[model samples]
Target: MAFDVSVIIPVYQRQELAVSALRSVLEQKGVTFEVIVVDDGSPDPFVLPADLADNDRIRLLRQPNAGAAAARNTGVRATSADWIAFLDSDDLWLPGKLAGQLAFARDGLLKGWPHLTAVMCGFTQIDLPSGSRRHRIPVESWNAAELAAGCWFGPGSTALIPRNAFEQAGLFDETLMRLEDLDWFMRVGLLGGGVATWPELAVTVRVGGRPSVKMLDDAVGRMRAKWLEGGRVDGDTRRNLAAYLALEQASARRHAGRWLGFLGCMTRSLLLRPRLRVPLRRWWTEDPAAAPQ
Candidate 1:
């Protein structure tokens, strides 16, 4: 039977979490979907649970240890559905996530909004160890210009995109170990594809240790070269991206329990943007261990 959506899961070393993520997909109702699990050469080879091994709706593919971008590209090639959704091995989907997003997309199509290449929903970030829920972002729409300025939502788990999006925007840049989502989304926005949101939380993203500050700086530098060179992005967009990167670095430092680093990043973020300076200044006064509400 034809499927409404193809859920591609890219797994690296996390086997247990991969199984749990698959279970969440299996629990999804009100949608016809197929699951493709691409194992990026985990040290301990991924095997389906005994019960799931006999299930025909799920397919497992194996490849050498390429990064998540390559694995997702491989999965996209094998997908038969017109719409595609991606879920990392460590994240999860809430109940009816697919059905609701699919309905929203259909509505957009009926309203002649073919430029709606992707539909994203809100997601909550849950910090590890403490497992405390951080701030919840409600879904909101963004035009091409707004998206071109900066990333606004979680794309890996919460995005339901048409297969053609990859064709037009191009696949995820395998070279980017970070910020591939932002890069791809910006390309989509440039191609006249506007992003819409479902206006509800539909995914849970587990936050863990982040890459080092040096690594993040390197990634941001690459982005600056790619987008800001030769006046591709205007001055406002450049500052917007700078402020966004600083805030992201601050959040990473906060998650890693580096107070001085967090403060430094926050200072740069607030200085560059200044719109949210007062509220964020108050946020810094709170306990560092406490997750943002």
Candidate 2:
């Protein structure tokens, strides 16, 4: 049977979270969709429950440990749906998420805008520790410069992209273990197709679980170099990107207890963009005492 949308979920050693994500997709209303779950060689293996195993709407594929980017690419290749939406194994789509995006597309939100090839909705980030939720609304429209300033798409999980756009933008960079979503979105922007936003929240993302700081730093550093070499962004956007990268490096250093390195990174970031507000705010809020003398 033909599907309106193909939901690609990449799972790696997160069986329980993946199962929950699959259930959320299965429960979506007003949209004919199929779920493609790619198990990226989870060490312990991923097993679908008996109920899901027999469901024709769900397709499970497995491959050696190739990271989330590869897994997503594999899932995309396995589907024939015209529209593609990605959901991280740990994230869940609220009811009507797919229907809402389809409505936006049918109502000319994308058709009226020549540059828009995708639509994404807002999302709520649930702080795992405190159970507090913060709603985030990404920009309704964005150009390359705006995207270079930051990852305005929020996350890969919130986006519903057309297959043409996906093909043009190419697959996510497999080398990037972190910030892969941002990298792919930046590429999409470079391809001259922007993303439109739906104001309502469509997904709930669980946050607060931390990964290795050094690894994050390396990934961001690689992303910075890649964009720089692409030369798609202007001087101001490049400066902003540099400032953002520096701030991320500083945060990583701070997390690693390297106070001096953190201070140095913060100083460099400020020098790059003296009026940069994010680093200054993070400096004061994260550790006022560690602020440079």
Highest lDDT: which candidate? 1
TM-score for candidate 1: 0.86
Model 1 scores worst on lDDT over the 10 consecutive residues at 278-287
The parts of candidate 1 lying over 4 Å away from their true place are 135-137, 148-150, 252-265, 277-292
Query: Model 2: runs farther than 4 Å from truth?
Result: 109-111, 229-232, 279-293
Instruction: State every prediction's TM-score relative to the real structure.
Output: 0.86, 0.88
Q: Write the per-residue lDDT of candidate 2 for residues 1-293, one digit (tens) a residue.
A: 99999999999888899999999889889989999999999998889998888999988999999888899999889888888999999999999888988788657543576444678787877879888766776665456655655565667888888887767888888998777776777677777767777777779898866656778878887877787766657677677677767777787788778899989988888887787465322211111222222
Error of 2 at 24 (Å): 0.6
Cα error of candidate 2 at position 215, Å: 0.9
C-alpha lDDT score of every prediction, in listed order: 0.79, 0.78
Clashing pairs in 1: none
The per-prediction CA RMSD against the true structure, in angstroms, equals: 4.5, 5.7
- Residue-level lDDT tens digits of model 1 in 1-293: 89999999999889899999999999999999999999998889899999999898999999999788889999999999989999999999989999999998989878876564688777777879787875444334344445644455554898899999898888988777778787888778767786776766778899776787666777777777887664676655566666777787887678778899999988987887787542322311222344557
